[model samples]
Target: MTIGGHLEELYGLPAFTFPGPGETPRELPEPDAVAWRITADSYDAEEQWTEAFARFCSAVDTTRVRALAVGAWEDAYDRGPGDIIEALVTARDRLPGLRSLFLGDMHSEECEISWINQTDVTPLLSAYPALEEFGVRGGQGLRFPALRHDALRTLIVETGGLPVEVVRGIGASELPALENLDLWLGTSWYGADSEAADLEPVLSGARLPRLRYLALRNSEIQDEIAAAVASAPVVARLEVLDLSMGTLGDDGAAALLGGQPLTHLRKLDLHHNYLSEPLLRRLRETLGSAGVELDLDRDDADWDEDDDGTVHRYVAVGE
Candidate 1:
């Protein structure tokens, strides 16, 4: 059976309850567990899916649900962006216990520009005050909502069209307790001259005071910008840094690695850039001397590998 099928089976089980003011609901059976997958090929299907989702949200004890995954088909063209955003916002508000939210195949017609302009993401963010990790995939032009969650720690944006400014706007203060940040920009960002301009504002602000892990993937950044990002005051306390697919050449990579004030950093990722053998050697030597673990992904392999893949392999730089 498919993953969706298995999730559906999980949702069909009895409701899971907890100790609260009212009766604790039991967990759903297997068949109904995958309520997040709404394949709206036809009007009837769309209506039925929405209705089922609403009912599930209202009946299921959200405190028992831990993760939420929203998937959209690449060819499903019937639904609009507003429909998906509305549905997602509804579910987010209803599921207060949600700790992780994954937005998959986000390029569907349901995630168009108009949908973003119309959707009020602030309320949805406000609802999930306990959210810990958020992942957005396959969409562009998504604005950041002013998040006030003390529990938020990880924010991952994986899209080709997401702007740099949006990523930088997520300051440490915005997530006072934030620790990990993962950003994957699209190929379109490579042509921009001021790619790192957006990040300056957040770096100057009191954002991410306690940030430890940071990842910047698939962005077209120059040496100067990379240096600036590395030298940013807020990042001085970082323990992990990932710059996969950032197009940082030897000079840029060297600048960033050499200029970084991250004394406690333990892990560093530099993948899919124009690093020659000499530059790679230099990076290894420099970071090794600093006692940091380097995770390097040369251009020899495909970058879209799974967790078990070799996209990120640890290399000891120093003795």
Candidate 2:
């Protein structure tokens, strides 16, 4: 299974799993959704692909295709934004009811998460105003300008290095009904320039009044982010706060432990971090007593030290 699938299972997300090649697709009735995993490898050698994507579009009742997952589209001929995106946009009239979309749904076997090329996705919001949930896995060349989409409830941008421009765009967006926001602030080498200042709007607790889940995760600067999130006014209203898959260390964990009134939160995910054993134990006891599910499942590798004993940490999944 893919990391995404595993994470969905772990978090109990309402995800629609896809079938393997040649397996029968899942039966999806009204209100429920089905995911179409497209791959260039599916085409036969002698077959013409001029109608390749079109076949999938025609096969599925687009109206019933609420959750569309794109996988290995990068291998499609003349790889660019226009390939599958154009097909979808042209079929928008037939997909009026489509709500959720997941792009770059391939695991490392198909394409490494960091290598999945993406373009500006703001056009999707314009094409599908009814879209409630949208997720993109890769960050390379990804761009999402600030745009108003009233029905959008969830926006997830997973990147090895999310650009600051994208961060600013999200902050400037007018998602009145946004409920869940997850941004993987990857390593600086991958163009992740967003700092605490760029995230101020989200942390203010005023921008998206309906927000309940916030994940500022997969960051090289998780400790700094943790310090900021510890005091963010939004924490009081959030149901789940994830700072996992990062370099959150003792200082960051201390900030979260000693600060924040997290008794009301439903879950706190701090997996794959640099938290010490004692701190993790204390955190478990504290959050457990408060009825908050804590995930400190994976500890960081032994800290990197130089001759002088200066320690260093790395952001999980940034490489």
Candidate 3:
């Protein structure tokens, strides 16, 4: 399944889209209570995001705006968000109350997840130091560097293929207050280039002390990820551990059941995987009794085309 729609709500605030060129924005009870969205009408629209952003800033009280969603820019499939990022950074003082920001919220219709060209978004983190939640989509031309930040509590990066440098950057970065982290490590066929070793720092929890939830979804190497995560020091502290939308099989599930006693975890999500029925039954029988909320749904129905011990699996989202 593809990303079908825009976010209904973000940071506990309803998303309010600022109208495109020649359109009118609706009246809001409080600008601060809504997540203001600034996006162009289309990918190749003559009216670019710069104009839309300028209009939003002029029409709304920026200081009171607490959340922002920057959707598809003009030619987002080909262009990086350098100019848009600069604009947001330049206007940082005007958005002092902005606590949540989502960059590149385009669905596959406008730009496929593997096609949106992104740039180094590290500047946003440094500029919006007070931001509590940050979400980014797409991975093509994406770049993230390791840095220190104290106030960020949630970080989400969704992509059809997440590169290694970005993953390693996050693993090495210092995020003391980060409680939730989600990384969609899509298939390598589209440029996902990280191994389980790349996740070592994050699994150690050395840099992210307050991390309580960790989701490593959509990977060609889901079993390796599961094996690494099974005994990782960070798993002991996480309330929710998600290894969904990937190629998980009985091998990975076995590692999870063997390495650590997951009774302490509140939830374990393994949806959209390639696990067999026996393992699924075993999981339900075992975790069900332990009160661990397990999600083993949508285990692909056609997972066994070969009996030669060679497995064929696919990730949920990839270009």
The sequence of per-residue lDDT tens digits that candidate 2 reaches over residues 1-319 is: 1244312311123444443345576654333333544445422322222244566555566666666666555353224445667777787898787787776666665555666678888888889998998888777878888888899999999888898989988988888899999999988877788897889888886769899999999898898899999889999999999999888889999988888778899999998888888988889888878799988877454358899988877777763
Q: Give each prediction's root-mean-square deviation over alpha carbons.
A: 9.5, 3.9, 1.7
TM-score of 1: 0.68
User: lDDT of candidate 1?
Assistant: 0.53
Weakest 10 consecutive residues of candidate 3 by summed lDDT = 299-308
- Taking the tens digit of each residue's C-alpha lDDT, what string does model 1 give over 1-319? 0012112211233222111223265654433244344333222233343554566566556546766555443223333245555676666645665676655423323433112222223444566778777665543335564556687777776554454445544542377767777766544532122356666655553766667887755555535457777778756767777776555667777777677555467877776566778878877787766888876766442334567773432211100
lDDT, residue 150, candidate 2: 93
Please, what are the lDDT tens digits per residue for candidate 3 over residues 32-141?
87888888854558687987899888888899999999999988878899999999999999999999999998877888888888999999999999999999999998
Sliding window of 10 residues with minimal summed lDDT for model 2: 4-13
Order by lDDT, highest first:
3, 2, 1
| TM-score of each predicted structure versus truth | 0.68, 0.85, 0.96
Candidate 3, position 303, lDDT: 50
Using lDDT as the measure, the top candidate is 3
Estimate every model's Cα lDDT from 0 to 1.
0.53, 0.75, 0.89
Best by TM-score: 3
What's the alpha carbon RMSD for model 2?
3.9
lDDT accuracy of residue 247 in candidate 3: 89
Question: Which stretches of model 3 miss by more than 4 angstroms?
Answer: 299-311
